[model samples]
Target: MSFLQRYKAGIGLGLYAVGIVIGLLFAILVVWADFEAYDFQAGLSVEQKTKGFSCPLAITSNESGLMTAEISNNSTRDANATVRMMHTLGSALVVNQVEQRLTFSPGQTHKLSWPIQASDAAWDRFIMARIYVVGSMPPRSTADYCGILLINSPFFTGQQILVFTLALALVFVVVGWRMWFVSNKQPAIDAEKSSRLMIAFAALVALNIFLSINSEWLASGPLLIVNLLLAVAVLANRLNKSTFS
Candidate 1:
Protein backbone atom coordinates (compact mmCIF):
# COMPACT_ATOMS: atom_id res chain seq x y z
CA MET A 1 0.00 0.00 0.00
CA SER A 2 1.13 3.51 -0.74
CA PHE A 3 1.64 6.11 2.01
CA LEU A 4 -1.73 7.74 1.15
CA GLN A 5 -3.68 4.54 1.93
CA ARG A 6 -1.45 3.42 4.78
CA TYR A 7 -2.11 6.33 7.16
CA LYS A 8 -5.35 7.94 5.98
CA ALA A 9 -7.16 7.22 9.23
CA GLY A 10 -4.36 8.63 11.33
CA ILE A 11 -4.21 11.77 9.25
CA GLY A 12 -7.95 12.31 9.51
CA LEU A 13 -8.00 11.78 13.25
CA GLY A 14 -5.03 14.10 13.71
CA LEU A 15 -6.67 16.86 11.75
CA TYR A 16 -9.86 16.66 13.84
CA ALA A 17 -7.94 16.61 17.12
CA VAL A 18 -5.70 19.52 16.17
CA GLY A 19 -8.59 21.61 14.91
CA ILE A 20 -10.61 21.14 18.11
CA VAL A 21 -7.67 21.93 20.39
CA ILE A 22 -6.70 25.06 18.51
CA GLY A 23 -10.28 26.33 18.36
CA LEU A 24 -10.77 25.83 22.13
CA LEU A 25 -7.47 27.55 22.94
CA PHE A 26 -8.28 30.50 20.74
CA ALA A 27 -11.65 30.85 22.49
CA ILE A 28 -9.98 30.83 25.90
CA LEU A 29 -7.55 33.53 24.80
CA VAL A 30 -10.38 35.77 23.64
CA VAL A 31 -12.28 35.32 26.92
CA TRP A 32 -9.13 36.08 28.93
CA ALA A 33 -8.49 39.29 27.03
CA ASP A 34 -12.05 40.42 27.62
CA PHE A 35 -11.84 39.70 31.34
CA GLU A 36 -8.67 41.75 31.60
CA ALA A 37 -10.35 44.67 29.92
CA TYR A 38 -13.23 44.67 32.45
CA ASP A 39 -13.02 47.10 35.34
CA PHE A 40 -13.87 45.55 38.74
CA GLN A 41 -13.10 48.45 41.04
CA ALA A 42 -9.36 48.02 41.20
CA GLY A 43 -7.33 50.13 43.65
CA LEU A 44 -10.38 51.60 45.35
CA SER A 45 -11.89 50.99 48.75
CA VAL A 46 -15.64 50.67 48.16
CA GLU A 47 -18.05 51.14 51.05
CA GLN A 48 -21.58 49.94 50.48
CA LYS A 49 -23.14 51.98 53.27
CA THR A 50 -21.84 55.30 52.00
CA LYS A 51 -22.89 55.02 48.39
CA GLY A 52 -24.56 52.12 46.58
CA PHE A 53 -26.61 51.54 43.43
CA SER A 54 -29.03 48.96 42.05
CA CYS A 55 -30.45 48.10 38.64
CA PRO A 56 -31.71 45.09 36.77
CA LEU A 57 -28.90 42.88 35.50
CA ALA A 58 -30.68 42.00 32.28
CA ILE A 59 -33.39 43.53 30.09
CA THR A 60 -34.89 43.00 26.67
CA SER A 61 -34.08 45.16 23.67
CA ASN A 62 -35.99 48.42 23.37
CA GLU A 63 -37.13 48.08 26.95
CA SER A 64 -37.51 50.83 29.51
CA GLY A 65 -35.97 50.49 32.95
CA LEU A 66 -34.87 52.43 36.00
CA MET A 67 -31.56 52.76 37.84
CA THR A 68 -31.47 53.85 41.47
CA ALA A 69 -28.73 54.90 43.86
CA GLU A 70 -28.78 55.44 47.60
CA ILE A 71 -26.48 57.88 49.33
CA SER A 72 -26.07 58.12 53.08
CA ASN A 73 -24.17 60.38 55.43
CA ASN A 74 -22.99 58.04 58.12
CA SER A 75 -20.62 60.60 59.62
CA THR A 76 -21.38 62.87 62.54
CA ARG A 77 -21.64 65.96 60.27
CA ASP A 78 -23.48 66.97 57.12
CA ALA A 79 -22.02 65.98 53.76
CA ASN A 80 -22.23 67.28 50.23
CA ALA A 81 -22.22 64.76 47.39
CA THR A 82 -22.55 64.73 43.65
CA VAL A 83 -24.07 61.63 42.11
CA ARG A 84 -23.93 60.88 38.40
CA MET A 85 -25.69 58.10 36.54
CA MET A 86 -24.75 57.15 33.00
CA HIS A 87 -26.03 54.62 30.50
CA THR A 88 -23.65 53.45 27.82
CA LEU A 89 -23.54 51.02 24.96
CA GLY A 90 -20.65 48.61 25.35
CA SER A 91 -17.96 50.90 26.76
CA ALA A 92 -17.58 53.69 24.23
CA LEU A 93 -20.79 55.71 23.70
CA VAL A 94 -22.95 57.22 26.39
CA VAL A 95 -26.63 57.09 25.54
CA ASN A 96 -28.13 58.83 28.57
CA GLN A 97 -26.78 60.51 31.69
CA VAL A 98 -27.97 62.54 34.69
CA GLU A 99 -26.13 64.37 37.43
CA GLN A 100 -27.46 65.73 40.71
CA ARG A 101 -26.00 67.44 43.77
CA LEU A 102 -27.45 66.66 47.16
CA THR A 103 -26.83 67.52 50.80
CA PHE A 104 -27.37 64.88 53.47
CA SER A 105 -27.48 65.41 57.21
CA PRO A 106 -25.74 62.99 59.55
CA GLY A 107 -27.40 59.56 59.67
CA GLN A 108 -29.66 60.54 56.79
CA THR A 109 -30.14 58.57 53.55
CA HIS A 110 -31.46 59.75 50.21
CA LYS A 111 -32.50 57.79 47.16
CA LEU A 112 -32.19 58.95 43.53
CA SER A 113 -33.32 57.31 40.32
CA TRP A 114 -32.91 57.78 36.58
CA PRO A 115 -35.13 56.60 33.72
CA ILE A 116 -33.29 54.42 31.19
CA GLN A 117 -34.03 52.60 27.98
CA ALA A 118 -32.19 50.36 25.52
CA SER A 119 -32.62 50.85 21.79
CA ASP A 120 -33.27 48.04 19.35
CA ALA A 121 -29.77 48.48 17.97
CA ALA A 122 -28.44 47.63 21.41
CA TRP A 123 -29.65 44.05 21.18
CA ASP A 124 -26.91 41.51 21.90
CA ARG A 125 -24.98 44.35 23.53
CA PHE A 126 -24.48 45.43 27.11
CA ILE A 127 -26.43 48.37 28.47
CA MET A 128 -24.00 49.52 31.11
CA ALA A 129 -25.37 51.56 34.01
CA ARG A 130 -22.65 53.29 35.98
CA ILE A 131 -23.02 55.37 39.13
CA TYR A 132 -20.31 57.70 40.31
CA VAL A 133 -20.34 59.55 43.63
CA VAL A 134 -17.90 62.33 44.51
CA GLY A 135 -17.13 64.45 47.61
CA SER A 136 -18.25 61.91 50.23
CA MET A 137 -15.64 61.81 52.97
CA PRO A 138 -14.34 58.41 54.16
CA PRO A 139 -15.93 57.11 50.99
CA ARG A 140 -14.29 60.04 49.16
CA SER A 141 -15.18 58.54 45.77
CA THR A 142 -17.12 55.43 44.75
CA ALA A 143 -18.36 53.79 41.60
CA ASP A 144 -20.88 51.07 40.90
CA TYR A 145 -21.95 49.41 37.65
CA CYS A 146 -24.72 47.16 36.36
CA GLY A 147 -24.36 45.21 33.11
CA ILE A 148 -27.73 44.68 31.50
CA LEU A 149 -28.28 42.16 28.76
CA LEU A 150 -30.32 43.22 25.76
CA ILE A 151 -31.73 39.76 25.34
CA ASN A 152 -32.65 38.38 21.93
CA SER A 153 -34.75 35.42 22.96
CA PRO A 154 -37.75 35.53 25.24
CA PHE A 155 -37.84 31.77 25.84
CA PHE A 156 -34.26 31.26 26.91
CA THR A 157 -31.84 33.16 29.11
CA GLY A 158 -28.19 33.80 28.33
CA GLN A 159 -26.90 31.08 30.61
CA GLN A 160 -29.21 28.52 29.08
CA ILE A 161 -28.13 29.43 25.56
CA LEU A 162 -24.49 29.10 26.52
CA VAL A 163 -24.98 25.70 28.11
CA PHE A 164 -26.96 24.35 25.19
CA THR A 165 -24.33 25.46 22.70
CA LEU A 166 -21.55 23.78 24.62
CA ALA A 167 -23.49 20.55 24.96
CA LEU A 168 -24.32 20.45 21.27
CA ALA A 169 -20.74 21.07 20.24
CA LEU A 170 -19.53 18.32 22.49
CA VAL A 171 -22.09 15.87 21.09
CA PHE A 172 -21.12 16.66 17.52
CA VAL A 173 -17.43 16.27 18.18
CA VAL A 174 -17.89 12.97 19.92
CA VAL A 175 -20.19 11.55 17.28
CA GLY A 176 -17.95 12.62 14.42
CA TRP A 177 -14.91 11.06 16.04
CA ARG A 178 -16.75 7.78 16.64
CA MET A 179 -18.01 7.63 13.07
CA TRP A 180 -14.47 8.06 11.76
CA PHE A 181 -12.98 5.29 13.91
CA VAL A 182 -15.78 2.72 14.00
CA SER A 183 -15.89 1.90 10.30
CA ASN A 184 -13.25 -0.30 8.69
CA LYS A 185 -13.25 1.76 5.51
CA GLN A 186 -12.71 5.29 6.71
CA PRO A 187 -14.80 7.83 4.86
CA ALA A 188 -13.00 9.75 2.15
CA ILE A 189 -12.92 13.41 3.07
CA ASP A 190 -14.61 15.48 0.40
CA ALA A 191 -12.55 18.52 -0.42
CA GLU A 192 -15.42 20.72 -1.51
CA LYS A 193 -17.60 19.88 1.52
CA SER A 194 -14.65 20.28 3.87
CA SER A 195 -13.76 23.67 2.44
CA ARG A 196 -17.30 24.95 2.73
CA LEU A 197 -17.62 23.74 6.30
CA MET A 198 -14.31 25.28 7.23
CA ILE A 199 -15.31 28.60 5.76
CA ALA A 200 -18.57 28.62 7.66
CA PHE A 201 -16.91 27.56 10.89
CA ALA A 202 -14.24 30.24 10.54
CA ALA A 203 -16.82 32.93 9.96
CA LEU A 204 -18.82 31.87 12.98
CA VAL A 205 -15.68 31.75 15.08
CA ALA A 206 -14.76 35.29 14.12
CA LEU A 207 -18.23 36.58 14.80
CA ASN A 208 -18.42 34.75 18.11
CA ILE A 209 -15.07 36.12 19.18
CA PHE A 210 -16.19 39.63 18.39
CA LEU A 211 -19.42 39.25 20.32
CA SER A 212 -17.72 37.60 23.28
CA ILE A 213 -15.12 40.34 23.50
CA ASN A 214 -17.90 42.87 23.65
CA SER A 215 -19.63 40.89 26.44
CA GLU A 216 -22.38 39.68 24.09
CA TRP A 217 -22.33 36.02 25.00
CA LEU A 218 -26.09 35.72 24.61
CA ALA A 219 -25.81 36.65 20.93
CA SER A 220 -22.85 34.40 20.19
CA GLY A 221 -24.30 31.29 21.79
CA PRO A 222 -26.83 30.69 19.03
CA LEU A 223 -24.18 31.10 16.35
CA LEU A 224 -21.94 28.64 18.12
CA ILE A 225 -24.70 26.01 18.16
CA VAL A 226 -25.52 26.61 14.52
CA ASN A 227 -21.90 26.13 13.49
CA LEU A 228 -21.66 22.82 15.31
CA LEU A 229 -24.92 21.60 13.83
CA LEU A 230 -23.65 22.43 10.36
CA ALA A 231 -20.46 20.59 11.07
CA VAL A 232 -22.39 17.52 12.19
CA ALA A 233 -24.56 17.52 9.10
CA VAL A 234 -21.60 17.76 6.77
CA LEU A 235 -19.72 14.98 8.48
CA ALA A 236 -22.75 12.70 8.46
CA ASN A 237 -23.30 13.26 4.77
CA ARG A 238 -19.69 12.44 3.96
CA LEU A 239 -19.81 9.24 6.01
CA ASN A 240 -23.03 8.13 4.36
CA LYS A 241 -21.45 8.57 0.98
CA SER A 242 -18.60 6.25 1.95
CA THR A 243 -21.04 3.65 3.29
CA PHE A 244 -23.03 3.50 0.04
CA SER A 245 -20.02 3.58 -2.24
Candidate 2:
Protein backbone atom coordinates (compact mmCIF):
# COMPACT_ATOMS: atom_id res chain seq x y z
CA MET A 1 0.00 0.00 0.00
CA SER A 2 1.05 3.57 -0.69
CA PHE A 3 1.89 6.06 2.05
CA LEU A 4 -1.45 7.91 1.68
CA GLN A 5 -3.37 4.59 1.89
CA ARG A 6 -1.50 3.62 5.06
CA TYR A 7 -1.92 7.01 6.80
CA LYS A 8 -5.08 8.26 5.13
CA ALA A 9 -7.06 8.94 8.26
CA GLY A 10 -4.26 10.81 9.97
CA ILE A 11 -3.47 12.83 6.87
CA GLY A 12 -7.09 13.79 6.34
CA LEU A 13 -7.56 14.83 9.94
CA GLY A 14 -4.33 16.81 9.92
CA LEU A 15 -5.29 18.72 6.79
CA TYR A 16 -8.73 19.53 8.19
CA ALA A 17 -7.21 20.76 11.43
CA VAL A 18 -4.70 22.92 9.61
CA GLY A 19 -7.40 24.52 7.46
CA ILE A 20 -9.53 25.30 10.48
CA VAL A 21 -6.66 26.83 12.38
CA ILE A 22 -5.58 29.02 9.49
CA GLY A 23 -9.12 30.20 8.84
CA LEU A 24 -9.65 31.12 12.48
CA LEU A 25 -6.33 32.91 12.75
CA PHE A 26 -7.07 34.94 9.64
CA ALA A 27 -10.50 35.90 10.96
CA ILE A 28 -9.05 37.07 14.27
CA LEU A 29 -6.34 39.04 12.52
CA VAL A 30 -8.90 40.85 10.38
CA VAL A 31 -11.04 41.79 13.38
CA TRP A 32 -8.02 43.01 15.34
CA ALA A 33 -6.73 45.12 12.47
CA ASP A 34 -10.13 46.80 12.05
CA PHE A 35 -10.33 47.70 15.74
CA GLU A 36 -6.77 49.04 15.78
CA ALA A 37 -7.37 51.21 12.73
CA TYR A 38 -10.61 52.64 14.10
CA ASP A 39 -9.03 53.39 17.46
CA PHE A 40 -6.05 55.08 15.90
CA GLN A 41 -8.14 57.31 13.65
CA ALA A 42 -11.05 58.19 15.96
CA GLY A 43 -9.67 57.58 19.47
CA LEU A 44 -8.20 60.95 20.30
CA SER A 45 -8.57 62.44 23.79
CA VAL A 46 -11.97 63.74 22.75
CA GLU A 47 -15.25 62.30 23.96
CA GLN A 48 -17.03 60.02 21.48
CA LYS A 49 -20.79 60.06 21.06
CA THR A 50 -22.94 57.79 18.97
CA LYS A 51 -26.34 59.22 19.79
CA GLY A 52 -25.99 62.44 17.82
CA PHE A 53 -24.42 60.88 14.76
CA SER A 54 -26.36 59.08 12.03
CA CYS A 55 -25.18 57.56 8.76
CA PRO A 56 -26.17 54.60 6.67
CA LEU A 57 -23.99 51.55 7.26
CA ALA A 58 -24.13 50.40 3.64
CA ILE A 59 -24.62 52.22 0.34
CA THR A 60 -24.45 51.42 -3.32
CA SER A 61 -21.32 52.50 -5.13
CA ASN A 62 -21.45 56.01 -6.59
CA GLU A 63 -24.52 56.81 -4.56
CA SER A 64 -25.18 59.85 -2.41
CA GLY A 65 -26.70 60.02 1.05
CA LEU A 66 -27.09 62.39 3.96
CA MET A 67 -25.18 62.19 7.25
CA THR A 68 -26.43 64.20 10.17
CA ALA A 69 -25.08 65.20 13.57
CA GLU A 70 -26.88 66.88 16.42
CA ILE A 71 -24.83 69.53 18.21
CA SER A 72 -26.08 70.71 21.59
CA ASN A 73 -24.78 73.34 23.95
CA ASN A 74 -25.58 72.15 27.44
CA SER A 75 -23.29 74.56 29.20
CA THR A 76 -24.65 77.80 30.64
CA ARG A 77 -22.94 79.95 27.98
CA ASP A 78 -22.91 80.64 24.26
CA ALA A 79 -20.54 78.28 22.41
CA ASN A 80 -18.68 78.81 19.15
CA ALA A 81 -17.78 75.50 17.51
CA THR A 82 -16.39 73.98 14.36
CA VAL A 83 -17.93 70.83 12.97
CA ARG A 84 -15.71 69.00 10.46
CA MET A 85 -16.49 65.81 8.57
CA MET A 86 -13.90 63.79 6.70
CA HIS A 87 -14.67 61.00 4.24
CA THR A 88 -11.88 58.47 3.89
CA LEU A 89 -11.12 55.19 2.15
CA GLY A 90 -8.55 53.26 4.08
CA SER A 91 -6.00 55.89 5.20
CA ALA A 92 -6.64 58.16 2.23
CA LEU A 93 -9.26 60.89 2.03
CA VAL A 94 -11.88 60.37 -0.64
CA VAL A 95 -13.52 63.80 -0.63
CA ASN A 96 -12.85 67.37 0.34
CA GLN A 97 -13.15 68.24 4.01
CA VAL A 98 -16.61 69.51 5.05
CA GLU A 99 -16.52 72.12 7.76
CA GLN A 100 -19.19 74.27 9.35
CA ARG A 101 -18.75 76.98 11.97
CA LEU A 102 -21.70 77.64 14.21
CA THR A 103 -22.62 79.44 17.42
CA PHE A 104 -25.09 77.91 19.85
CA SER A 105 -26.82 79.47 22.86
CA PRO A 106 -27.10 77.64 26.17
CA GLY A 107 -29.65 74.81 26.17
CA GLN A 108 -29.77 74.96 22.38
CA THR A 109 -29.46 72.01 19.97
CA HIS A 110 -28.85 72.23 16.22
CA LYS A 111 -28.99 69.45 13.71
CA LEU A 112 -26.36 69.69 10.91
CA SER A 113 -26.36 67.68 7.72
CA TRP A 114 -23.73 66.86 5.12
CA PRO A 115 -24.02 65.12 1.79
CA ILE A 116 -21.93 61.96 1.57
CA GLN A 117 -21.21 60.22 -1.68
CA ALA A 118 -19.76 56.76 -2.14
CA SER A 119 -16.92 56.27 -4.59
CA ASP A 120 -17.03 54.04 -7.65
CA ALA A 121 -14.57 51.76 -5.94
CA ALA A 122 -16.33 48.87 -4.26
CA TRP A 123 -14.65 48.89 -0.84
CA ASP A 124 -15.26 49.85 2.76
CA ARG A 125 -14.84 53.47 3.86
CA PHE A 126 -15.34 55.71 6.89
CA ILE A 127 -16.82 59.04 7.80
CA MET A 128 -15.15 60.78 10.75
CA ALA A 129 -16.84 63.79 12.29
CA ARG A 130 -15.45 66.06 14.95
CA ILE A 131 -16.87 68.95 16.94
CA TYR A 132 -14.56 71.28 18.84
CA VAL A 133 -15.45 74.40 20.74
CA VAL A 134 -13.46 77.46 19.78
CA GLY A 135 -11.01 78.63 22.47
CA SER A 136 -12.13 76.17 25.13
CA MET A 137 -9.62 75.48 27.88
CA PRO A 138 -7.88 72.11 27.30
CA PRO A 139 -9.76 71.77 23.96
CA ARG A 140 -13.25 70.42 24.64
CA SER A 141 -14.13 68.19 21.70
CA THR A 142 -16.22 65.20 20.62
CA ALA A 143 -15.72 62.70 17.81
CA ASP A 144 -17.87 60.17 16.00
CA TYR A 145 -17.52 57.77 13.06
CA CYS A 146 -19.59 55.73 10.65
CA GLY A 147 -18.43 52.83 8.48
CA ILE A 148 -19.86 52.84 4.95
CA LEU A 149 -19.92 49.95 2.56
CA LEU A 150 -19.52 50.83 -1.13
CA ILE A 151 -21.16 47.88 -2.79
CA ASN A 152 -24.01 47.22 -5.18
CA SER A 153 -25.97 45.22 -2.65
CA PRO A 154 -27.01 46.52 0.77
CA PHE A 155 -28.67 43.32 2.01
CA PHE A 156 -26.17 42.54 4.78
CA THR A 157 -24.12 44.55 7.27
CA GLY A 158 -20.62 43.77 8.47
CA GLN A 159 -21.77 42.44 11.82
CA GLN A 160 -24.23 40.08 10.18
CA ILE A 161 -21.57 38.79 7.80
CA LEU A 162 -19.13 38.24 10.65
CA VAL A 163 -21.61 36.22 12.67
CA PHE A 164 -22.47 34.04 9.69
CA THR A 165 -18.82 33.46 8.84
CA LEU A 166 -18.00 32.35 12.36
CA ALA A 167 -21.00 30.03 12.56
CA LEU A 168 -20.17 28.46 9.19
CA ALA A 169 -16.57 27.94 10.24
CA LEU A 170 -17.65 26.07 13.34
CA VAL A 171 -19.96 23.80 11.37
CA PHE A 172 -17.31 23.02 8.75
CA VAL A 173 -14.71 22.26 11.36
CA VAL A 174 -16.94 19.67 13.01
CA VAL A 175 -18.29 18.06 9.85
CA GLY A 176 -14.89 18.02 8.12
CA TRP A 177 -13.28 16.09 10.96
CA ARG A 178 -16.05 13.49 10.90
CA MET A 179 -15.68 13.15 7.13
CA TRP A 180 -12.15 11.83 7.43
CA PHE A 181 -13.29 8.76 9.40
CA VAL A 182 -16.10 8.05 6.96
CA SER A 183 -13.87 8.40 3.89
CA ASN A 184 -11.33 6.00 5.39
CA LYS A 185 -13.82 3.11 5.15
CA GLN A 186 -15.03 3.81 1.61
CA PRO A 187 -13.92 2.22 -1.68
CA ALA A 188 -11.18 3.94 -3.66
CA ILE A 189 -13.54 5.87 -5.97
CA ASP A 190 -15.72 7.03 -3.13
CA ALA A 191 -12.64 7.94 -1.07
CA GLU A 192 -11.33 10.01 -3.97
CA LYS A 193 -14.65 11.82 -4.26
CA SER A 194 -14.67 12.56 -0.56
CA SER A 195 -11.16 13.91 -0.70
CA ARG A 196 -12.09 16.20 -3.57
CA LEU A 197 -15.13 17.41 -1.68
CA MET A 198 -13.04 18.21 1.37
CA ILE A 199 -10.50 20.08 -0.72
CA ALA A 200 -13.24 22.12 -2.36
CA PHE A 201 -14.73 22.97 1.00
CA ALA A 202 -11.38 24.08 2.30
CA ALA A 203 -10.88 26.31 -0.73
CA LEU A 204 -14.28 27.91 -0.18
CA VAL A 205 -13.37 28.59 3.41
CA ALA A 206 -10.20 30.34 2.32
CA LEU A 207 -12.09 32.44 -0.23
CA ASN A 208 -14.62 33.46 2.37
CA ILE A 209 -11.83 34.51 4.69
CA PHE A 210 -10.30 36.71 2.01
CA LEU A 211 -13.58 38.43 1.15
CA SER A 212 -14.36 39.05 4.82
CA ILE A 213 -10.92 40.45 5.63
CA ASN A 214 -11.20 42.92 2.77
CA SER A 215 -14.63 44.01 4.08
CA GLU A 216 -16.53 42.53 1.15
CA TRP A 217 -19.38 41.48 3.39
CA LEU A 218 -21.93 41.75 0.59
CA ALA A 219 -20.25 38.95 -1.31
CA SER A 220 -18.94 37.04 1.67
CA GLY A 221 -22.36 36.63 3.28
CA PRO A 222 -23.89 34.89 0.28
CA LEU A 223 -20.78 32.80 -0.30
CA LEU A 224 -20.96 31.58 3.28
CA ILE A 225 -24.59 30.47 2.80
CA VAL A 226 -23.62 28.60 -0.32
CA ASN A 227 -20.80 26.90 1.52
CA LEU A 228 -23.19 25.83 4.27
CA LEU A 229 -25.57 24.32 1.71
CA LEU A 230 -22.70 22.51 0.00
CA ALA A 231 -21.58 21.04 3.32
CA VAL A 232 -25.09 19.84 4.07
CA ALA A 233 -25.45 18.20 0.68
CA VAL A 234 -22.11 16.47 0.95
CA LEU A 235 -22.80 15.18 4.45
CA ALA A 236 -26.19 13.81 3.40
CA ASN A 237 -24.68 12.14 0.38
CA ARG A 238 -21.98 10.53 2.52
CA LEU A 239 -24.53 9.16 4.99
CA ASN A 240 -26.44 7.39 2.23
CA LYS A 241 -24.37 4.26 1.51
CA SER A 242 -26.32 3.44 -1.67
CA THR A 243 -25.03 6.69 -3.28
CA PHE A 244 -21.49 5.37 -3.08
CA SER A 245 -22.39 2.03 -4.74
Leading candidate by lDDT: 2
Per-residue alpha-carbon lDDT of candidate 1 for residues 47-137, written as tens digits (9 for 90 to 100): 6422457655445444566768778788988889887766664443435667899898888888888765556123345555557787665
Question: Which residue pairs does candidate 2 place in steric collision?
Answer: none
Q: Model 2, 1-245: lDDT tens per residue?
A: 45575476656565575556556454444433333335334444664443476655444544666768777777888777777776553344443466788787877777988776555221354333333323231236766554554444455544465455466666656565665755476688877886776667777877877775664545666776676577567557756844775
TM-score of each: 0.44, 0.43
RMSD of 1: 11.6
Clashing pairs for predicted structure model 1, backbone only: none
Off by over 4 Å in 1: 1-51, 89-91, 120-124, 153-245
TM-score of 2: 0.43
Model 1, C-alpha of 136: deviation from truth (Å): 4.1
